[model samples]
Target: MSISGLNTLKKGQHYTAKELDSFISTTDAVLLSNNENQLFTDPEREYKVTHELDGFFEHSEEDAEKHFREKKAYVVEKA
Candidate 1:
């Protein structure tokens, strides 16, 4: 899948172990280090995080379209 654009997830999303590791690679050490020094430490946290990430990864395109459409409508109304 593609990995860039406003539709692409940047942070704050659920992620699989592999996906989380990939994210960790691109993240700052301080942020990760403060989070118990690991990305997938707790199973419960992992589950929740992964679920959120999955939703974003799967629906980001649709979400972006909807977001832009709403923004455009708002701008039109304001003008």
Candidate 2:
């Protein structure tokens, strides 16, 4: 998706599965790897993050940054 403004989802906040899915879908990302990873079509990229219980999708540390920056994913940092 081509969001014109800054993101409304805070930097570190948890969101429900439905909410997360909606954001991903609206952004034109295809849920992959059993909803763990997402494939972005426009850029022809795939993002996979390690899954956390309270987070939208599993994000690995290696890929988290890219995923967050590209998809504007809501990432709730662990305490």
Top candidate by lDDT: 2
List, residue by residue over 16-38, the lDDT tens digit for candidate 1. Answer: 44444454456432122224444
lDDT of 2 by residue, 1-79 (tens): 3333323443334444444445555553333234333322223232233332222444578755533324333333222
How many clashes does each candidate structure show, in the order listed?
6, 8
Q: How does model 1 score by TM-score?
A: 0.26
Residue 49 CA error for candidate 2 (Å)? 11
Off-target runs (Cα >4 Å) in candidate 1 are 1-12, 29-46, 50-79
TM-score of each: 0.26, 0.29
Cα misplacement distance, residue 53 of candidate 1 (Å): 17
Among all candidates shown, the one with the greatest TM-score: 2
